[model samples]
Target: MAQHPTDANVYFVPARSKAPIFASVSMFVMMMGVASWLNDVSWGKVAFFTGMAMMIATLFYWFGEVIRESQGGHYNRQVDVSFRMGMVWFIFSEVMFFGAFFGALFYTRQYALPWLGGEGDGVMTNALLWDGYSAAWPSAGPGQVGGHFQTIPAWGLPLVNTLILLTSGVTLTIAHHALKAGQRRALLFWLGLTVVLGITFLFLQAEEYIHAYSELNLTLGSGIYGSTFFMLTGFHGAHVALGTIMLLVMWFRALKGHFTKDHHFGFEAAAWYWHFVDVVWLGLFLFVYVL
Candidate 1:
């Protein structure tokens, strides 16, 4: 039976859950596999894929329980408030995560590079280490640290991907509006379009990476530029893929009439995440690509 508002005078607490433990173990195995793979262990790939499969399975089962509880109306106003607060903190954590990476980029460009080039108070240090070194925005350092490589122009695939992500943000907003207006057909159409745009952006990003590695001779080892380039854009790409999956799940749920106009916090949360991803891409385009 669906839980009524007055069914319980106190907040409902769930029984002990093993999902956290399961997830922890899965992550441990995954990280171990990654370390092993980096060291050239033959079975490392197998372990890595195995761990990923386990992690996906665990999340599906664990979240399935939450979904069931939600649909059963076990959640009260207090529970809803808790959910909102949890999401807020979760997104805040993500902001800090990305902020660290961006900070690294800024530090390398503003301070580290100039110090190495003997600017300001770095004169003696540069003379002792890298005499005649010139500081340039996209330099590979004194000895071409990781070999010479060309950069992908800001106006190429990067620009196109920017447009794609911006368009996705618009489409998702339209979908949200449609949901609120009870236009189920329009909601599904626009939401599906947003998912398509996300996938397209990923496809273009992969193409850009391919060109960088093959024709441009740019790999992860191509100095600090390559490292930061891959770190920022790569993480953002992963976020896009994740957001697409979330949108797909929401699309399926919408098809099944899971959300009503006033009770669609689930959809709202997913949309918020998608917009966050879009905003991060804009930062990447401006800082990593254009600048």
Candidate 2:
């Protein structure tokens, strides 16, 4: 039920919610579960799944309340502006997050690897310390630290996932335009298509990871190459999963006629997030896979 305004001038002040606290606790549990699972704890997987379920439920209920508030016309132009600014900062922070991982990749490839191979510092460090060291991209460091592992070629699954993400960006933009043009049916259709693409991309990534682990023997323990490779791609995959869930929620809101042509920040925010994920994947594809 939408809230009817009694006074036009009063700004709506929402009561404090426990969503953030619940989210924090669930995240802590999830991390603990992950650490325990890595150490082969008996109940680790159970805890992880339980935490995941709790987090999902929390988000669903919290966002549903927010939707109700939105439909109730609680937010004003000022609130909308604040939402936009908040989203901008959130995306900016994500940029820095991925930037750190990329910076590590660059430093390792450009400086650390060369120095260890005795290319810089004008010292034959490889010969003096470790003989017959091969300095190559996708290398497992000196003496093949974690043994030999084949690198996944950039022309196959990775290229396919890249195309998929790019196409998703297009679909999402189309959906945004449809919303702005006041075409609800087209908006829902295109938004749902974007979610499907996101899911497909995740499925393909899972397949790729399985191939890397089983056929290529490229585990996280595979030294510098594998560590960086998995780190970048793994985090990106998690982002994609999150963005997909956001889109799904927006899709449901769309179906409920929760957005109008002039004010659909919820849809816009999800689109922004999805596009960010797409852009990050392009970076990973180029630096991690191609270069």
Clashing pairs in 1: none
What lDDT tens digits, residue by residue, belong to model 2 across residues 190-289? Answer: 9999999999999999999999999999999899999999999999999999999999989988998889889999989999999999999999999999
**Position 184, candidate 2: lDDT:** 93
Q: Output the number of the TM-score-best candidate.
A: 1
Candidate of highest lDDT: 2
Which whole-number lDDT from 0 to 100 does residue 182 have in model 2? 93
**Model 1, 58-91: lDDT tens per residue?**
9988988787777877787787788889888988
Tell me the TM-score of each prediction against the true structure: 0.96, 0.93
True-vs-predicted CA distance for residue 22, candidate 1, Å: 1.3
lDDT of each: 0.89, 0.90
Each candidate's number of clashing pairs is: 0, 0
Candidate 2 lands at a TM-score of: 0.93
Candidate 1: segments with Cα more than 4 A from true spot: 1-9
Q: What's the CA error at residue 165 for candidate 2, in Å? A: 1.1
Considering only N, C-alpha and C atoms within 3 Å, which residue pairs clash in candidate 2?
Answer: none
Summed over model 1, clashes come to 0
